[model samples]
Target: MFKDLYDVIVVGGGHAGSEAAAAAANLGSKTLLVTMSLQNIAQMSCNPAMGGIAKGQIVREIDALGGYSGIVSDNTAIQFKMLNKSKGPAMWSPRVQSDRMRFAEEWRLMLEGTPNLDFYQEMVKGLIIENGKVLGIRTSLGLEIRSKTVILTNGTFLNGLIHIGEKQFGGGRAGESAAYGITEDLVQAGFEAGRMKTGTPPRVDGRSLDYSKMNEEKGDDVPSKFSYLDSTKPLVHQRSCHMSYTSLEVHNILREGFDRSPMFNGRIKSLGPRYCPSIEDKINRFADKERHQLFVEPEGWKTCEVYVNGFSTSLPEDIQFKALRSVAGFENVKFFRPGYAIEYDYFPPTQLRHTLETKLVEGLYFAGQINGTTGYEEAASQGLMAGINAHLKINEKDPFILKRDEAYIGVLIDDLITKGTEEPYRMFTSRAEYRTLLRQDNADFRLTPMSHAIGLASEKRLRRMEVKKTASAQMVNFFRETSVTHQEANVVLAEKETALITQSDKMFKVFSRPQIDMQDMMKFEKVKEYIATHDLDTEILEQAEVQIKYSGYIDKERNNADKLHRLEDVKIPEDFDYDKIKSLSYEAKEKFKKIRPVTISQASRISGVSPSDISVLLIFMGR
Candidate 1:
């Protein structure tokens, strides 16, 4: 049935594939998304939530760049929260609990409505590569479809093996069939393949749980959204999640099943995410701990199925039931489905360029779990970049690469390609050195203009970003230019229990103090008048407040980033021979040759490359 050649062919329809297909098609490419099951497009295979800590920043960045994840997340949200409100702006993150079924539906609908995008149901078995370049894909039915560029976002379906205690099965997810051939094909084609494991918790019937025994966690009084665009709004009503704990009794019951556990029995040897370990692994690792926390989260607004967060496991079903029964709130819990761990094939991301294209195969790219990343947000961001670069490369346009100071997406890709993750990689705010400059609040300001220039972000999105930028700047300037009297400042200062000012000063001066915030400055008539007259919203006000309060720290980070940019500007010749550098350390030489970093800044970030080694390289480069 396939007649005409396409620009991009995306294999797999999970978070990464969905974004990649959307981005490629939205950039004017004729894109086709081929998956094992079209109904499962963009499924939340693990959790029914998006955005957390650094991940929230990534979702916002995706939205700014015209990807549909943020918009879909906002549309399907059931609960919303701004994490780390008491922390610095850089630490502040927006997260949401979603209606699981709706989340996937929203994504599918968005992709269907997108121009130049098409969907097909099929398993891609192998790529049609010729002379080191990909031409298209060969389906399991032996149909050859042609495309200029191909993106692989196979997620965990690649030769997937699911383990539940001693019993095992060949399924990608609970009922989904495993995908084969592609891994073998790639491995035979000179790609290195590794196995990585990840797990999800059991889903219990919410009606059977006694919520009176647990503590309720509510959403924020005023919820915020993930998308910077005005297309989606924050939740007006929300659902409350419940918190429970696992006791020593519960731990003992779990211990009885250790001999049968796939994790403890070494039935699954691949490493799982370190930060998100299974409940069995947790008790085994932290034996001294009396108990562990577990959150009882509803799967959707109307469904009785509840996800048992922090209780991920691959223990036998009987053990899961017995142990969970001992928990405070789950005494009568009935299982919707038991948790299991899955191991799948992944390629070392060091083989990928910054644009996410494979270094060994021209016009071929890998994203999501195929690149060893764990979270949906991480996968989606990589997909977005891969799609954009694939379109650009085919069109003979410049590739888009976000700098470390620009977005969390940059740190994610750079870390993978440079350091290479042995375990499933996840993003964190602490991972980025210039976190102060890459805050979640200003992602639109940081990325929208660039995306617009690339023909990805729409003109309407660009205008909204520009309006926010101008309004926030005006607000910051208003604080700097307007002065407050001692009487007025003392009223606010005394209320906050801070030292009263003896004389009038710029509102910015008083607001810069640790105790003062935008609200305090808004207490001034002039500040309030400026906001009202300009009709500034909460987003604009928050942006201006962060700029005003954290101006010193922001400037310092900006200068540090600028200093690093000098090294970034020092490009290394692609064909430069690292073996000839006799003075360089053996480890440094190997890393330099393996990663083949395009810039000195990237070279310095490699794990084994020391300061002395950098000095040697700089001297050799005639710096």
Candidate 2:
């Protein structure tokens, strides 16, 4: 039994669906999360980890927006690492290896505790639509539930087909039944759908691996967490992941099974993620390479299950076993399960607006794999936005849209709805043009206020953000104003092996040098006193250090972002006629009509829309 009419109904319970439900419920909407199995809520369907590269920034942004992903990740993390520490602050990302079971459990608990959310278990076979508008959902048992808006976060489950070598089966994932009907319904309803493929690595028994033959990858000495909140703590005792390699012999063994592979044999036609390719694909594509690296990661703190990273494949099980046995540490590996590739139906993101609402169907939204995004972080971010916007739509409020410079989430959505990815869209540092301003450390500074204004981020969150912001600004000011004597500066500079100044200079100038860092500055009595007197935490100090050190780069990026914001401000009316623009190229016109980008900046980012096309539009608009 379900409510007569719910505010929002979320189909599926993966990262995307979970975030969507949480966001809608937290925003005071009566939301229902319907999944095939409630037990697998927010499952880490691929890797048992969260955040990597630009994905980390997304988790931080989710946390900053009062979403539960970051908090859930921190609560379940068995190991913590801040990746790209050696790189600039802009490149730094926080990552975690999670206890798979706990990650899902924590998410369910968080969702259950939320006030306006309800849960149901069922397969949503079709949408309740009338006159090009979705009203609710129809379950497999012919049960109809009415809702004001429906969010389909059906990740990899729309007519899903799993491929394992020559053997193909209908399934969403390992041991899960495939969902059907919805794709056909939507297709018949005039939405264009395409197939996309993604794969997972095998799970093996950790006891079978030989750690002595591999390199141990430990967590950070002082591990950091994903959540900005004090709700969870950084991991203390941590598990170590081991790294091994695939030798020429291993590749030779794998190549023998290539004929049987779904990928090579043309049994699977859909495109998979190019970056995260299967082992067989990797070895075949890079034949010149003698060996490929493999990460042997533990699945949980207590479980003997291990995940064989970089070994995703859909070769014959015997072939998988034989090839993996030749690796450095997996000489006698025991399989928990073999890896397989799954192909699923996805609607072209071009059919969706910036709010993730379908252009074809009013009050209907799509997120996660349905939108052609690959990673959990990307899906979750989209889900959160979709949920927020869906609720706003029903309540007659302006939709919340993040801009390109403001967040990586903004860049992700903009790229999806604008470019329309053919392959699975993954977030990367290179994707965001204004990454310097979108650093992971300052996500709260960038997004908390906006989320707070929207009534999602709590007053406690706002207060915390305000306090951190004030403290960091004061610390940066101290660095700018305080001068260290040459005797003090040279000692610190000499220790860091940097050129010592002959005279006293502002600490900010000295600290701005690449060789100098916060540790060195903290050695100064004045700096240490300021930090102690202000009762500054690591977060505040780190934020201040980045601001002080990268102020010039930050200012330049902000200036660039501001200049571009003019184009973003130039809003195009919803019914703007692209067909009448005689000077526009055929491809540009087609893209404009399809994507229907709301702003000139969004229009400029469309793949085939050249700068000249933008100039023509600007002139036409009398800019």
Candidate 3:
């Protein structure tokens, strides 16, 4: 019951594997997605949510590239919000509260609908490598499935260790068993693997909660969907989450369990996410704070289960219950399940190329938790790229790698493959140098053309993008060419508390003023008539506004990126012996040899490789 060959075989059917399988198959690769359980494909292992901060940008990027994450998220979302709306456009992010069951089911349905994609339920135990190239994979049942490329997205399943207080079990998730054979084989093949831990909070029964004691957190008045393709429409009715806090009594009860806590007792040695710490770690770290906020989020519209955000822990069940009961609004609450931490193996991402293929093993790739990243969005984006590159490799086409200036996905891969990470890495707005140009409002603007050229973005999507581009240009042109009289602008200006303009001004110039809004400028009747005739979306208008307002900053960053491009273009030969460069320090040579950075720009980002070492390399190269 197995094929001898496949173009690509994706192991694990989580976020990364699902994306990888879909992308490769959609690109014409005869792909096989093998997982332990088909029903858990694209499962939200930790939480029932998607996107936040920089992660949202990644989802949009995936969508622009014709990936299914955005569409699945849109179809499954129960509530939606635009985070950081009051901030700059670069910081604006779209997040969704999704139905976990629907999210996974949607992914499975999307994959099933995709051509060239085949599904199998099995655990790949070893790789069949020939001459340092991945030839195929061998499963636990002694069957070998041949493939030109193998993408390993074994998220938190490889030798997974779950800790509940002092008790430990071998499982990827709460009840899911750990994967075996691959980790030992990879280690035997000289791949370095380390342990990293991540935990999820308890699930509570919504019916057991006292909603009157908590503050209601509603979705945005005008909710937005994730996909730009309009594959799914937004819901008419949205669900609401609640906000509650842990009191001093809760902290005291939690403290009672500290002695037996796995994290505190040194039972767990792996590092966890710093930004999303467990409640135990938070209380220990922020001792001065009397309370910590816990968000009561619904698991799905059809279920009464709620995920207790900001309440992650690995304490004993009794302690968990007691501590939870001490929190406000949870005094009479009951839990569906207790939280636990799982430690799993992750190979440092530096071992992979920008295309996500392993440098040591051709046609072999890794993504998601296997690569040491934490979030669902990060895993999904990496999966999509890995799938694309795997397909390209099988087709004998050039690898599709995005540059830092191109998309947030590019920045994520570049950073991971270049610098590597010791902890469970998560995306942040501060990581991207060209954030102003990478605004979420214009992800399609930046990536749709490339996706269309590559045959991922459909013709219909491209046509829609073209219309948006044309309409936005028309709006910009109207603003640049149209002039408004002082009398027409004075009324709006006075309303906004600005001094009246004595003469005519270009609409662009007027709109550029910090206090002026496009809606307010519509009072001139000319602006309103132009907008009504064009019938543009708010996104296009917002993009034009950001372009005009932040033109200076955007240009400056572009120039900076241009200057850095020269360094990026300077290739560092893989076999170039850093030890031969006598001017380089011992530490720099050791670091360079280990990382083997592809370019001088990447070499500069290495932790121990200093500016002086870069200068020495440049001088030695006769630059």
For candidate 1, lDDT tens digit of each residue in 36-73? 99999999988789998889999999999999999999
The candidate scoring highest on lDDT is 1
Per-prediction RMSD in angstroms? 0.8, 1.0, 1.2
Predicted candidate 3 versus true structure: per-residue lDDT over 1-623, tens digit per residue: 66557999999999999999999998888999999999899999888999989999999999999999999999999999999998878899999999999899999998999999889898888999877898889998999999999999999999999988989999989878999999887887778989999999999999999999999999999888888876688767999999999988889999999999999989899999999999999999999999999999998989999999999999998999999988878888888899999999999988888899988889999989899999999999999999999988888888898888888888899889877999999999898988987888889989989988877888988898888888887787888899999888888888999878999999888888878877787787887787778776777877778877777788998899999999999999889988779989898898888878888988898888889999999999777
Candidate 2 residue-wise lDDT, 155-176, digit = tens: 9999999998889999989999
Of 1 and 3, the candidate ahead on TM-score is 1
- Compute the lDDT of residue 429 as modeled in candidate 2: 100
TM-score of each: 0.99, 0.99, 0.98
Reference-based lDDT, residue 311, model 2: 98
Candidate 3: list runs displaced more than 4 Å.
none
Show pairs that collide, candidate 1: none
Q: How do all the candidates rank in terms of TM-score, highest first? A: 1, 2, 3
When 1 and 2 are scored with lDDT, the better candidate is 1
- How many angstroms is residue 332 displaced in model 2 relative to the true structure, after the best TM-score fit? 1.5
